[model samples]
Each structure stands twice: as C-alpha cells, then as structure tokens.
Target: MGAFGRNHARVYQQLQQAGSVRLVGVVDPDTARADAIAREFGCKSFGSVEQMLTTHSEVQAASVAVPTVLHREVARALMEAGVDVLIEKPVAATLGEADELLRVALEHKRVAQVGHLERFNPAVRATLPLINRPMFFEVHRLSVFSPRALDVDVVLDLMIHDLDVVLTFVKSEVKEIRAVGLPILSGKVDIANVRIEFESGCVANFTASRVSTERVRKLRFFQAGQYISVDYARQDVLVCSVGSAVGAAHSFATDANEWGTRPSVNPQIQMAKPPITAEEPLLAEIKAFLRSVRDRSRPAVSLEDGRKALELGLAILAEIGRHAGRIAVGKG
Candidate 1:
C-alpha cells in the first residue's frame, strides 16, 4: 500500500464488517509499511502476495493496489492462483500489460474487476437513465498539488476516471484525439487538456490538473434538447430539459405556448434532480467485486473496459507529445 493503498485497505476492512468477505491479509514489499497499514485495519501483513497466499490459501478475492508497473505481475500471480481480483485503475502501465492481465483472467475464469471507482458513483448511476444521444461533454477534474501519483501524469492519475465514464456513456469508437500537456511540480505532466471525437459524432473536452490551487470535479453534458450536469465530489446530478415539459408542467405545456400568449418557437423548460442513494464509491466497488467473485459473474467494470480506458489514455499521451513537438518546431 502506498498513497492510495491505505484507502483501499480501509474500504476492505469496512467491507469485512458489512458483509461476508473478510480482510485476511495485506501484502507489501516494505514490511514496515505493510505492518503499519495492517495494524491500522486489524489485518495481518505479509512481505509479498506469494507469502500471503501461501499462508492464507483460503483467500478468494483481492484488490491489487500495487503501483502501475507492478500491476501485471501482482495480478497475474493472484489470477494464476485462481483468485479473483479488483485491480486498481489505469489497469496496467501499458496496453500490452493490460491485454495480458485480461488474458490471464479469462484463462483462469477468474472474476476480474478494474477499479474505476467513479463507475459506482451515485451521481453517475442516477444519470445513466437520463442519457439520450449525448452530443457534447465538458469535464474538469482539478486538484491542488500533491506528491502522490507523481509517477504518472495527470492523464492517467486524474483524467482517466472521466475518460472511462465518458467512454461508457458514449459507447463509440474514438475517431480523433488532440491533447496538450506540460510538467509543473512533477517530472511528469502535471496538467493536461484533451479533446476527443467519437465515431458517433460525440465530442468531449477534458481538463485535468494536479497542480491546481483549488479542487474541482464535475462533468456536464448536452444532448438533444436536454442538458445534464454531474458533480462527482458532491454526488449530485441535475437534469434540465427543453422541448419536453415533464411532471406537473405537463398539464400547462399545451396552454401557455399554444395560446399565443408566449412565442410558440420557445418550448417550455423543465428541470429535475434525479434521486440518488449515495454511498462510498470504493465500498460499492469492493462489494460488487466480492459479489462477482461469489457468483462467478462478470464485474461491472470488466478488463476489456479498463483496457479501452488505458488505450485511450496512452493515445492521449502520444497526442500530447506530438502536439508538443509541433509547438517546439514552430517556436524554433
């Protein structure tokens, strides 16, 4: 467990109390770090996944929270042992690694999950029923400078969540990608802007920055005659509609605009706040993973889904580099 691993450990412990699964063991290469987190969560610690699995053969499922590079190795070992896994986001460091993880999971028939926590967000779940030909999206995920996750750029660390969500929503092939990024506080790209066009003619613009002064996480989209907004931090969703008056306004729709009292060209507007049952996204993800393991069913965020997100992330990184080279040549 490193920066985000403590949170994973905490959620697993919470899951232990709330359900049938138990937190059997936590493994870390650093014995001290593993012991500290284990003690905090009332679980045992081991030097590695092998040691843990050797001692605790009853372990059926695990959360692979290792670093980006170690994901393939850690997850491969677990799956090979016939254990289901919920590997954390970015799935793997590269597309090849991601594909291998998927292959192993399939060959082992293990329940594999990708840690796209936002997929379980109450706001996102609530907004799903409201989707209808989403034409455009504007997403922003900003955070104040943090030393954690500096190993990778903001594209993988922060923007990938939105990328996964948008890809799920659009369900279309990416046709074009234009991106720009620069390093600020870290050696990796600390801030980035991306514009993606999909085969469905949908367009999305994303902005992610780890060197921001304020924290903001929100996504807003426009569809045909409707606008929807999602607040990730607050777990809230707001849907505004045009050309379709709903609920109580349905009775008055035909009266006002049709009687010549108002312009017929303008349609009555309606706004609705979809009801949401808010829960910790991580907890929900763990619960879902455990359920998948027990039932041997596909996870909500499957390996293929994670791979697609990683592919897009890698593509965006390449596009950023290409743009940087163009800018440098122009400057020269």
Candidate 2:
C-alpha cells in the first residue's frame, strides 16, 4: 500500500494491453490519488473498499494495496465479495491476520496472490536454470531511508524480499534463524541482517538496509564447481568456474645475471559473463495473475508462500527484540 499502489496501477494497465484483463475501478482513501489513477486508466474511482465493491460488480479481481494494518479488513471483504486478490507483501502485519485471510480464501474458493515481485525478475529466471545444488547463498538489498513505511520494520519491508527468494531456492524448512537490527532514521528498525539455516544444510546470509548510501540489489549463489552472481540493477550475470590453462610466454631479458630465471605461472581461469535480458517483471506478474484468473490455476506466489515469508520476517523481528533486550540489560 502507499507508493506501491502506483506500481499496482501501472501493472494493471500493462495487463490491459494483453486483452485478458481490464481496470474496472480504482480505490484509495485519498480521493485525489484514486481519481488520478482512474483518470489515467479510464476507470472509476471509489474512496472506500466497500463502495468500490458495491459500485463495481464487474470487478472479478482486485489488487489490495492498503496498509498492513488494514489488509485483513479489505482483503476479507474482497474475498467475501467473490473477487480474487493480489495483496502487497508481508501479506499481513501479523500471522493471525495472514492465517485468517488464507482461511477465508480457501473457504470462498478464491485465489489470493501475494506480490513478491522478485519471483518474476528475469535474473531469477535465468539463474534458476543454472543452479544445480546450491549449498550457500547471499543477498543484499539496500535503499536510502524513506518515511513512507515507518509502521513496519526493515525486515518486513526490505529483508522479506530476500527471504522469499532464499526460501524459493532452498525449498526446505528452516532449522534456525538469527537476526540483529537497529533503528536509525525511523522508530522501527531501519537496518537488519539475518542468517537462516535450512534443514537441507543450505544457509543464506541476507542483509537489508533502508538507510544506505546507495541502492544495491544483488544475490550470489555458491554451488558445486561455480559461483554465480546476479546484479538485478545492471541485469548482469557473472559465472566463475575453475579451469586450467597455460600462461602466455613473457618476454624478459636477463643479461647480466646468469642465475636469473623465469618462473612459470599457471593461468587457470575462464569466465562467461552474459548480459541479462530485461523484461518488465510487473507486467509478467500481472500476466500470471490474469492467467490464474482465466485458467483457475494457482499463482506463482500464492497465499501460502506469502504466509511463510511473513512468518520468517516476524521471527526476525522477534529476534531483533531479543537482541535489543540483551543490550539494554548489559547497559544497566
């Protein structure tokens, strides 16, 4: 919700281009914002979810972009109205709310997708094919501080992205998790790092900061025989593997010293760097949503996936609190 609503509107417009979906209506508490989006998409604007559902009977699906605290109310209303939902991530502020949403969606037989946009990133798609047996992974996502999402900690707003990605890659249960964070610009923790140990013996080290010098979004995979790095910003993939090769002869002159000798150096390296093709991930995500709507198939990022990401994020937040308590006691 918040600025993310703008992205939801844009993605909906892109979905219209495929002729499978249409922007039926837009809703935001801010009338100006809702009107602006409606005008841009040639749709009607409603100031409340209740009014939107009542006025737009043709809306079979909705993009719920409300704040975390209001997610349960809005999503439940939409699901009860027989509309599929695509809710923005950290599905709900609390596990109870997320679980209730899941239950209602199931009871109503509605599709509730979560917006984890990284799953649609082209780099992720390209890297998925190359990964054989990932033993370890690292990710860093940093952004300059903004006051838009001060209600939630950095783990939910920032670290959850990497958590979803790691969970997708490992596909195993988490054995343990350790996290530490501190508040900098906002009352909530603005910088956080987490270490997750999966039952598959794979570990993921992740760091996310909303207060940073510059934005950095990257992931690294260390698997057997190779290391892969994907720079989401640059859309670049670099693969390094072990190789053996002979070094080219170097021309050297040792005239005065007879004992001077040239030592042979082994140059064993081969690097294959490929330019990653850029595609609009939001467009792909919306297209998938449309496909799910039409075919009644499961979403790429389903409600269950969102629940897991939220659970891990909440666990990290709890860990942060525990660490903070330790520091307070030490100071006393």
User: For each candidate, how many residue pairs have backbone atoms clashing (under 3 Å)?
Assistant: 0, 0
Q: Which residue pairs collide in model 2, if any?
A: none
Please give the RMSD to the true structure for each candidate, in Å: 4.5, 7.6
TM-score of each: 0.92, 0.90
lDDT of 1 by residue, 137-220 (tens): 999999999778766788998999999999989999999999999988898899999999999888999999999999999999
TM-score, cand. 2 vs. native: 0.90
For candidate 2, lDDT tens digit of each residue in 1-332?
25888788877876677676788778888899889888887778889988987777778988887877778899999999999988888799999999999999999999889988888888887777787767788899999987786778989988888899888878889898888999998989999888888897788889999999999999998765567898877767888864533322222223535222545566455678765679887777877877788788999999999999999999989988998999999999
Q: Quote the positional error of residue 227 for candidate 2 in Å.
A: 0.6
Instruction: Output the worst ten-in-a-row residue range by lDDT, candidate 1.
Output: 245-254
- In TM-score terms, which candidate is top? 1
